[model samples]
Target: MSSVELREGLVVVAKGIVCVVTKFTSLDNISVISQKEGKRFIVPFDEIEFFPAVTDEGVALIAPELDELARNASDDEITLAESRFDVIGRYSCGEISLAEALVTLEMSRSNFYRLKKNYSEEIGMLSLLRYNRGNSKGALKLTDVVERYIQESIDEVYSGSSASISKVWSDVEAKCISSGNPLPSMTAVRKRIKMRDEKELYKKKHGADAASQKHDARPGKKIFSRPLERVQMDHTLVDVILVDNVRRQPLGRPWLTVIIDQYTRVILGYYLSLHSPSAVSVSSAIYHAALPKFSFLQKLGVDVERYPYYGVPEIIHMDNAKEFRSKKFESACIRNKIKPEWRPIGKKHYGGHVERLIGTFMTGKVHFLPGTTFSNVVKRRGHNSDKASALTFKEFTKWFVKEVCIYHGRKHSELGCSPGSKWAEYFGAGGDAPMHPPIVSNPFKFKLDFMPEVTRSVSPQGIEFKKCFYWDAALRLHVGKAAVMIKYDPFSLGTIWAYLDGEYLPVHFSDVTKSDFSLEEYHAQKMQGRGEGHTPAGGLEDRSLAEYVHENKELVKRSQSETRRARKAEAARSEYLSSQREESNEIDVPVDKTDKADRPNYSRRATPFKGKNYD
Candidate 1:
């Protein structure tokens, strides 16, 4: 029972299960303590342990087992196990977790896990464990040799070919012999080491090594000019298995749509929904981004709107999913003066920002949460099958627009700051960074346009558009002669609504009779399997729209030549009429007022969030 501490100028020498050294009170008080005792002694740091008085009620955590562990451990064994005790106590006391210590020590987790579960040596700690290197762990034991060999073999198998196992084992053996260390047989090695540990080690080492090589880490490029010129769009699946509380049933898998400014890494717009990343979803995402709620940031002195990219993306980079390239999607981007930048087929690294975001959200955070979650409303709906357990299309949309996105805008985990802050920093508003001057004007204009149109049908029951329908007695009046506008989803004919003049007629498309097929449907039914049909997820392989159009220019030009001639004739007629009217006005005569009278203004509506919400 040696109660001792190391004295100045005296090193503890550890022999086979024994030690010899002078123990004293302190570095400066060493002479006094030794003079009083009048004897030299040896004990490891582990043998020198203490607990505050039981009656003292000190703030230091009272580990009931600690005092017993100290009292039980012999003097000689403490020297060798000093490192072990220190790590355990510091870990048990929560001064620092075992993980932090292990990472600091750069040791394998398996060793520490075993030590944590089984070892009970009392070594004085963080102060010592940090300074003392565990170099004298001694020559490899039989199990240690076997484990090392197995890990090396597994590493070999993963690094290259599995059939090279024999060569790998021979290589390790030759190295061990060269280094004068005992080596294990291939069979002993393979049987002793667990495959899971090998796989984990291999993954950790290889992953870190690969990432180090991959992250060349050049400074990121500064974004300049047209707002959405480069939007990094990605599809992330959130998996909380959201369920309708009332029905206790599944909702659906929620898809997260993020429109990030590639140059700035600003999240221009974002949305979450039980729907796929459709055109509507993309539009909704951009719309919210185009009009973000920045009042909080404004109060924080961030003027986001004045920032370079307050709204509108010029180029949206997306994967080659069908949803990204469908006519509806292309039309939206074209109408909004945005070019859809498609990643090369199957090449993801180029679009890593948004792609990685998906992994970060689903597997990393959402699903990794400790308990159950109703995160994937869409997938849940498929599982639950209860309508009530589902989110109304409108409600899901608002939540995404208002909450999910707002949260992303403020959360700083991913982007250096909240995504919205990046906008200000990049644009030279809030940040002290120098701004890249803006381009005078975007060379690209809207290559396409959207004509607000609808799908309609006059029926005894009702008409539908995009899976919804409408029916009203007023619609009956317009059934034959009136222009009954079917407020429809040009994307899906299943839903529709009847509109007459500028008024919505009462009727939901879902309420329409579902008995018969329309003429388009009849044709589609007859022509089943004749073609690939409307579309699929895959895009038209490896080519951009401009390239596609360029390749077909001759044929398309010839086809549109007739339409071009008609348009030219109308322009010439209008020019002639204008010239005559101008001449008559010069002669002081009143000109015909037909032009003004013929095109009377109809009902008009104000655009919501007009212009852009920049800051």
Candidate 2:
């Protein structure tokens, strides 16, 4: 090898980014970056734009077409990757960052940077052109849509923002409108809006449904039956984070759900989430609670299979919510072999046990950050934020063991004595060693994703959904194909890949695939069509229930169902009106026969406790 001493001169431009090529013994790759605290990127020789000019010291590099890269490269693609690499390199190689190297090489960071970036990324340049061209034609609306899509990609970066998707969309529209821009077509605008709305709806619906699923997962419907017989769980939303150091403003309350022994209230499991009260986090808390308490479980008369809840609760209680009634929830209960017992709607007494515990958090030591609503109060109380920084979810769990099993171990202040002593005294939980061992998470392992049978049908072209068929062009080869299994990534809400006959295709839905945009609306229209005729198309001859029953049993049954449905519809309308009335007394509430039927139920629940009888 020739005698060539390598000096870090003006880091030369390679590809479109700034890079430095060391002329020392055969170097294979070069890392380039920007100096800004949060803005940096790296590109190998192939990716970076390099200048033909080479200084005596080494090759000089500049971030050519920096604007294009800034526009097209994702924050993670550039900023995060660069920062992470630099940090890692500092630890491992102690290599100076690209910006620093540039400073030392060319004596001017910006000047050397300009030289390296002689070439622009054509792809990024094209994207810029695409965005700018839309300016004359509802471009801002399109920009708003793109922004939303991009925002989701980096949502974690702005997780603190309270701006909802709808709010953001509205803000975009207003800003454009204020500038006298013509709005995008309403249909197109709605197409843009529905994407996020669908996920939100799905998330809410699933969360509600998951609660019952948790019940189904209980080792027993009632934990007291014969040791680990059942577990009862409920989530509480609380206000916390008195001072959000990140935002320098108050944060919304956190939600925490605990899965406890329906029999022991032993605090078997719990989870705290930044989101509001939800089933997903509730399940997580329960999962964390369940997996670890196993060794202690055998002591309580439980095993692995026997662990999932069995024998339904004798009297389970919760405020009426969709989570309690969802089909999935019911199925979970059925699967776990437990009968679900739901508290009467709005009945506070029925839920008093769980409610009172939650209440303690509200008035007890749990601190409520300002702006905390009643919902927030409950969350802050259950969150176990005192140990929020625990390295692992399981470690944070130690806080519950300390709080519920330790500090509160005394003569049930609430239990009348300490839970441990109370357990020995009342439930007869004495002398039995915990069944399995205290459950611990396998830090080396992660949860296997839940795999559910997604009801689907396949044909020549692709899969069919809601009476519509969708198959990407690449899949056309497999048209009239057999059933294909698709796994979805929850975080991205996108298809991870598809499997056809056990072969992974890595295929995702493409633009050509028509989405179920009007699924809910179409179903509503179908239901409306079914509701058109009751007595008769033109005559009242069948109006009498007896006549209808005699002529057509089906008609009679349908009429009865229609009657019930009509009553429900009327009640819902009345309830909505009543809510509006509360907001503004001048608004007249709707009159409904169902309201009369419902008022009694509400009044009964709200009735000052007359002792606790459903009847």
Candidate 3:
């Protein structure tokens, strides 16, 4: 009847009922079995309406125009789809166990099975792309009145009490009846309670410390056989206190975020700052890990010949810090083919490699610094870290790099060779035939992809960040538009990249003559209430921010501690920007002073919410 081909195992509708095509008895007739009943029958091909297949397991199915639709999807959507496809691909290749796949994908057993089946049967990437935007089947379907009633009852009845589920459900039902709302079943009440976080539930029922004790466990270590296969990331406050760059006064201890290759025990990358660890620190470390480090070392003036460690890791193991759990970091990892694996709640041993490496560094080398605080209070009691502070932030950074080089060359007890030797054994010209993992081709674009992003409206005047306006001739057409996604280098405040249409257009300070300044310096000046040069047009006055900082000697002397800390942070920012500039020739991202011609003519992957209004 229809020109569409009919073959065995193909799903189609026959006589208003869903069925699987068994065979074409002849050109004029086809045999089919009812999907629900398994009853076989032959029907005339002409009599069949040739129903278009549209549903799968009660979910609406999309047509197979996948390629065009996929290309049209936002960058985030495409990245997420590819990530799901990668999980399924790994499972199919037998590279990861099904259990590991389930954990990595963060999918339930049944959900993962359905995804695998759909991926295997149809367009893999398309199937992984979620077309449904509503709640899945079996989700709680209670009205607001019932939900509120249950919540109130739970707060009044079960919280801080050893009440059983049945008791709580009975109380919730009674409350629902009294509230004049439809009563939910015991199963629904249990499911609602189960939907809550286990830690929250435990804390509400028992206590906060009890919940922590329950979740904290020391599990065995995980071993990997290849470099970059399972990298571990963690952050710690440096044991030693440091001084400022200019004044060399005692500053507070800085935070350090480190990433290490578990297989080779080699340090991949690190970020240091006076501020505590945040999403920015984690992102910078990841960006650093994926970039070629030869230029970075040369710029630092470190004498190390090779630190050949850079790639999109297969799995990044991390603790349950909020920074590691940020949607931005997770999205970046998935986009780059990295599987983020959190250490099981309470399983400290899972991150042993990086932990031990940090410990060795701090105890073995850092404790010898002039302002060392040592490891514990007992050891640090007489140190007076602030009074004994000696090294400036720059000096400390150079010394840290030298220590890292030294650490890489020493023999490891477990491997019976140095980390550098192990790295070369696997990736060098000989050894076990080198394994070349994916290298980050465009380091600058890679950094932008992982950098912090914020949404702001484009005013006729320009885009404002930290009370500073950035504008460009190209942004004039985009004025009056809202939710222009922007990415900025924290180290440099004079320029920012605005996502317009599809590409990141670099916008500079409205006053192009002003010198670039670090965010830390700006905040420090603002906090001191010294550099408030306001113009009549609700803008900053035309003055050199650098000059203002230089003239504020009294303020710096009055707030020595805070100024020293700020200077240390600014120094870190300066070094970071320096490394970035050194590697700019390897990528297409334009530097400050946008000439349009020098800018990279590339479009970022579109995000799914491209059309949504930020207002």
Candidate 4:
């Protein structure tokens, strides 16, 4: 072989297999790591017939000698002779010395002399390359028996058997001995299996999903030009234990919905709830993302310079999660002129940025908390996360917000700058200022667009929804209208927006006090009261009255619990609304009570009975 062909890391053919040259042992011998079999072999220079040459553009150039030989010889002849003549021809023409050519070419001195004499006499180089087709030479070849044994072993392994290569080889040996047939070595069997492509092997063994994820990996890194141009949204079950707001008892884990800016690696918005991810979670996350964070921070009682990230992204990239793929979420994105891009099903790596962020947050921040699960089962084996829990929902929220702020200010490896600095660099510069999506003119209107909608008809009593009555003076105008669309927040069922003639009229619960209860709590109470026997008015049965009273008491308890929750939520909302109104330069519109007084009183009032007397 030429010196160029002996370079380390160059690929060359040895023994009918491709190997990479690791180092030269001598002028005649080189150490090579076989790419095909993954073993080290020290072979003579004459055994190397081809080596790869790559161009500047990364195109592989085929060996000229191999191409020339192919034109003059059959492919089977090349395979049988293993291209040894091409190496011999180079040495015979003074390309290299004879001592450097005779090390380990797998030929005896007599055979070499015979080949050299044949080359000198009758057939020339072609004669030197020819192999006697009938010469078996007592070498062991894989017979039909051995091949069948190998196929059986592979099938057993693919069938979920715990059989290792050694075990399979033992079985093959036992079968061959019993049948009085020769058995192939384990190395040969392993090589045959390795020659099969990984994708096909994994698919047969583990199934298609595993095969795709393991063997058919995807490209890394999604590029974006500016902040908020595109974002990734996903939900994760938080790894730290959280307690109920009022009871201060462990509530297992909370679910967090996060919106991440792809360009700057900034966490744009997040929502934490005890409930699982749903359309409500998606809406809340987007609503938070599209508004200033000042109000939210104020409501959380967190004092920061600013929580700068707030905008509607041009495109939101998410996995094909049920919540993300919901019609309500898609409709909201459309209504706001944003595009929703759902990654292909089972391709979780497409949303890798947010997934990595969740990992980083859980590892760096959450694991240090008192009630951390420590990510996986092994790490959490001895730790009772529930018992160690000390943080209430509010406390956790505060800590989470602070950690997010710290993350924004900390340097990111990918960005080479803090997320906050990147945001400032783009948004602060006037000429190339980051393009912010249009500000929401009215929070109520913006939220309504995203809130879940239901169709109902207005009646003389009111619009009945979720087993409750909602009323508005404007609803009277459309009392008989069928298919009136009502949009409401599941978090706070205190108010709803009724869509009529392209306008959404605000509606409140008919009994003002009942509006304080969320739909979930109301439903719970209704279920608890269902099927209870009613007591007779004239003659009350003690058992029936006791059951009725017990049901009513449960209802009252639920009502009180719901009222407390509503009060807290309302306070936060009030603070947020006040801040929003101030920021938007809008004044609160006062309702005209004169119209309320002039409207006919539909509410029932009791009149005193003048003539009724007890005997």
RMSD of each: 31.9, 35.5, 36.0, 25.5
lDDT of 4 by residue, 76-191 (tens): 55444444565567667888666555653566667666766644322223344454366334344689878888778776654332435676677778878988988788887776
Q: TM-scores, in order shown? A: 0.37, 0.30, 0.48, 0.57
Poorest 10 consecutive residues by lDDT, candidate 4: 118-127
Residues 444-465 of candidate 2: C-alpha lDDT, one tens digit per residue: 1211122222435455646654
Q: Scored by Cα lDDT, where does model 3 land?
A: 0.76
The models' CA-based lDDT, in order, is: 0.51, 0.44, 0.76, 0.74
Assess the local accuracy of residue 130 in candidate 2 as a C-alpha lDDT between 0 and 100: 18
For residues 384-496, could you state the per-residue lDDT of candidate 3 as single tens digits? 88899888655776788788888889999999999988888877656567665566777778889788789999999999987988989998898899988989865567789
Candidate 3, backbone clash total: 3
TM-score of 4: 0.57
lDDT-best of 1 and 4: 4
True lDDT of residue 320, candidate 2: 60
Error of 3 at 120 (Å): 84
The segments of candidate 3 whose C-alpha lies over 4 angstroms from its true place after superposition are 1-221, 435-437, 457-462, 466-469, 480-482, 491-495, 509-615
Q: Arrange candidates by lDDT, highest first: which order?
A: 3, 4, 1, 2
